[model samples]
Target: MKNRSVLVSGASIAGPTLAYWLSRYGFDVTVVERAPALRPGGQAVDFKGAVHRTVLERMGVYDEICRRSTGATDMVLVDAHGNERARISGDFTGGDVEILRGDLAAILYEAGAGHCAYRFGDSISTLRETEGGIEVEFENGPAGNFDLVFGADGIHSRVRRLAFGPDEHFVRHRGYYYAIAGEPPHREQSDGPRRRESYAHNDAGRLAVGSGAKAQQMYLFAAPEMHFTDEAEKRRVLTEKFTGMGWQVPEMLAELPVLDDFYLDALARVRMPSYVAGRVALVGDSAYGNTLAGFGTGLAVVGAYVLAGELAASEGEHIVAFARYDRIMRRYAKVGLGSSPGPFLAPKTTYGLWLRDRFLGSRWFGLMEKFAGDAKDDLDLSGYPAWEAR
Candidate 1:
């Protein structure tokens, strides 16, 4: 087997997925995650574009995701009193398949573990770039040398800071904050609430409920317009904002006090002008986390595909592979991010929300259909030059 030792940071969607492709290409791969184990039931994330779907198919886990998808049929724009002014369909709002982040993580972990070496409850402490490669210090295991190290870690990547610099130099907060925790839907849900009536359940402690789709799992959170100077401050702010919102919001907040990953700062997009430096390269949210526009998940997978393919095509020449990967991947990323997930996440103002609600009533729903088709074509992987694995 051709084994060019590679050390990857982060074990989320990107890192493990990258490990899958690299191992397929006969590379010695090791992944490190800060979390002790795979986190369960995080916010629901989805795959819309074709490239993402392609990656899942390639990994042989797409079918599993389809089975686990929270097929929430509808959503209501609700008021405190539970009055629904507008509603959106799940297939229309999410993608062809939408699964909880934890479920997706589980699928990836199952596919990747045997093929790649994984180190949990640890991270890279320091990195020194050199002529042959970079010297890395681990927070847990013994330090070692590798031909290449990747920062597939999420938006708040330690590899990015160690290799590049502080996050302030890269992340762009899109003017919002959010927090979430798993809970039981107060009103009980089969497909989602048929009608919109929102209120606090005294014992159930659910807000505006209908299990996401299955009614088996639920979550609640509050997002306000605020700028978090750093990740630490972001969690603190969430703690403050959600400490007492009543209903299920308070419960989610209460849970936040104990867990580590429960409270995520508002949506922030990682914007790096370039993703490569010498022998090292960054992928996933570490490089261009267009969380604001296309919801980083698909973009990360597409990037992983292109990166591993380019590396294999170039026979592990770092510079050539990274440049080609960036050239092809960035354009698609720009197109999708430019499409704007911001509006869907949090409208800028009341007027903007009103406009969105107005559009929901229009037969222009076909616009979304056309948009989805165009997006699928845009994510087409056949356009990429495939590499013959050694």
Candidate 2:
């Protein structure tokens, strides 16, 4: 096949997944990640509906993923007095199956590692399109030319910026921010009966949820667009936003400084007219990502499958394959653009919070769940028999 040498940016979900399929289809694949190693223990991500299941089964990682599954835990919403006001089923939030982001990444990496070259602690600094291929310069490694380059980096994707335009052109802040932090001391008790149920406490515009043992904590709050230069700054901002709140909020903030896995970012979405620019293309979040939208992981896995299948079917003609991938993915990825989870999780007004509680306690929430399931399955997945793994 022509254009068989491919470079995928990012070692997270999308990059490794694309690498797996491309290598399986007889392409030389290289994956570059900025982190020095595979990041461990991230917030849980889920895969729902038949489309996601089909891709996982095709990749032959379904059983293993199921083995590692973090069974869905119902989220109970409470007030300042720790009174339960409403409950959101795990079936609604966690999808069919939920697993830590790090675990999922590890699985995808292991499946593809045997056939792909993984370059950790490095990232692409520049991309130059040439007659023969795209010349890629790494932050800490030797430059190389690849027949095709893909950006699965993330919403702040370096490849997207270099190949497309700046972040302002595509990434739009969704008027909120989120943070994930874990207290290692309590992790041992994570599987305990109390920890099996997640609890959320909301005060006006802010929401704090913790696995009962305080092992993992997720905080969402409404905020204007802002930037933090370091983890200290992020921690400070989180403290400032969530301090003096009730129902374990004070305790969760107190553990923030000692938590090793603190992560904070804007709940943003990437909008683009296309996923391809000449020899360069983007997949996953770099293509269609809405932070915490609940469909990103599934979209990434499926997008990789389709991109690789198209390339193999077209005999590695990137122009033809890229266009086809873009068309199919854009349609399937629309689910990412439907709504932002911030306002839903952390409402800005007391009335909004009350309305959310009422909604969750009512029958309308069931209809909404059905709608989300339908959206997840709304794709005519094309099969590439010729590219099936031996």
Candidate 3:
């Protein structure tokens, strides 16, 4: 892969992770992000299953993740009345380990700190695959030629839009509209819905709190089966949905007027027939993303592995590596994002959510625990050619 240049879109999880591995495997890598810089904390992401661990270990960040992880011990299911229904320990949750999404992104960025070219505050405006190589022009004004390009630019990827026609063709609506913003307050806001007294293993269990940070904090809001085309539409729908939902919601909505980092969108997934399209390939959420599936992290880590390993195995030949990258990554993404167990976790309908809480939480709790205990067993990370480059 010497002298072969690659431009990965979005410096989020997958792009940085892939950049480190590709750089290690002898590919010149550059990651571009629309964000001005590595975004600060907003949401918490979990890492479950053995593959997550394997990838982190390989990247040499597993210990760091555990070190900086939010040890959320117990999860209490409460109703609109704040009445507790059931309690689920973090262990019973396969991906129980949770961390601020920004922290994880920071760890990934650190991995390629020096080796990879990081161009922040910009993104790919256009990508053209020519006879000799792919000619790429960036919004930040960088022009270059790359043997191949990968899009890890999250759910709404420009590369995917440009490479694979309009997003409507590949985006499968998952029948839900999710949104998260911080709760506005005076000062000293409590952590929203704490799993226990302390975030650590508190079996005795106490009520969770709100964000105990400074007031005017970011909060989260989600509505189901809403309509929206873009960011403004999403905000309007959110405003319409929670106009009367009480419990400081009005205050949260009031903050919405000034909220800049509002993550509002219909819960959706990309159901591409295949990830590979010409010399451009899609990775992470751009390829397979089922927000309801709860495998965004898994799909991302696995995709990085496939992309790097395939490139190394194929030497510098973009064709062979690109093809094999598609072969391995598509299957992993399918299993991780299209699995059955996920919708049960974040069901869209009342009935489906009831099934999860009642059947899984009540009478079948023991069975569910057993399955969760063995959740990592289904992962088959075999046949991946380990590349120790000469």
Candidate 4:
């Protein structure tokens, strides 16, 4: 058994998943989360290629994930008065099984809890590199030393700031920003499941899609680098941008204050020179967060698997493990992030939006899908011992 200790920051999707694999490899893993408990209310995230499914299958949670999947594979684009403009099917949208992000996180946490130590409502305050390990100071807990530390915290990673530098140096904003929140669909039926309508305002460039009991309200717009310090200011901007819009926009705004999972961020990608430094390394979004490209979740899981496998293969030598992890994921991440459709999703001009809608409504979209093929990720999972054993 590998006796080295590992500290992973952020108990979200990546951190918990990484902890799971590391624990399986006999590493003493600890996951620290800033939130008090497991957070809920994120849209469905799915697996695409064989590589992603292989990792999930190895984790032994694939069946459970499929069972809990939202099964919302098709979406229709509608105008202000709830009329369908264009329809996108399962092939273009959902890859295979699509489960809610929160549900997936819960599954990973449950699987890892027995083997990995969990610290909630706490965060790393400071990190100092020692001769043999990294010394960490917690915001709410006592200081400790771990053989290695990882920053699996999302794009706005605190560990990145402490170890690397500010986020501005790494994140590249792709000319737009988006906000999403789960809210009750308008005009519900109590007899059975609500017959929800996925509406999109072509002129407004906003969308409202069905997601369980509450639907997800999507607000996307093109902007040139603006800053809002607090949530109040962010909400104010959202209100200003979407006040007089149509198709449930008014209702979603009304429910925004009460919604627990209101998340907003720039539709950006992280571009780091390197993902490691000494005993500290980064996984998932901290290293490669291609927001709105629909590949973040899969990348997180695969990255976690590779990081743990490399550690186990290297026998707790972080220097070798980190280098191999970087070498394997760097090109994969580059290709993935390069293919992000952020700019195409939310075009700047009204003409661009009209063009986008026209394509969606036309045969071009279908033709593109036919050529898309099932082969996206190309990572060789067999090389890793963890995956091979499974």
Which candidate number would show the highest lDDT if scored against the true structure? 2
Q: Write the per-residue lDDT of candidate 2 for residues 24-62, one digit (tens) a residue.
A: 999999999999999888887889999899889988999
lDDT per model, in order? Answer: 0.68, 0.89, 0.67, 0.78
Which one is best on TM-score? 2
Error of 1 at 381 (Å): 2.6
Query: Where does candidate 1 clash, by residue pair?
Result: 82-198, 177-266
Worst 10 residues of 4 by lDDT: 187-196
**Winner on lDDT (2 vs 4):** 2
The TM-score values for the models, in the order shown, are 0.81, 0.96, 0.82, 0.90
The order of the candidates by TM-score, greatest first, is 2, 4, 3, 1
> Residue pairs in steric clash, candidate 4?
none
lDDT of 4: 0.78
Cα lDDT tens digits for candidate 3, 1-390: 443788889887889988988888888888888888998765566777677777787788888777666555454555445455555665554265666678789998997868998888888888888887789998876688887788999887899998898888988666545565553222112443234321111111111223333222322233345555788876776677656543344555666766665676666878888887888888888888776355687678778877777777777677787887777666556554554332544454556555665764565777755664355335465645357433
* Best of the two (3, 4) by TM-score: 4
lDDT of 2 at 209: 89
Q: Which ranking of candidates, highest lDDT first?
A: 2, 4, 1, 3
Q: Report the lDDT tens digits of candidate 4 across residue range 162-279.
A: 9999989998887778888764233212342222335555453444443333456777776677888988888788777777878766777787776656777787889898999988
- Cα error, candidate 4, residue 9 (Å): 0.6
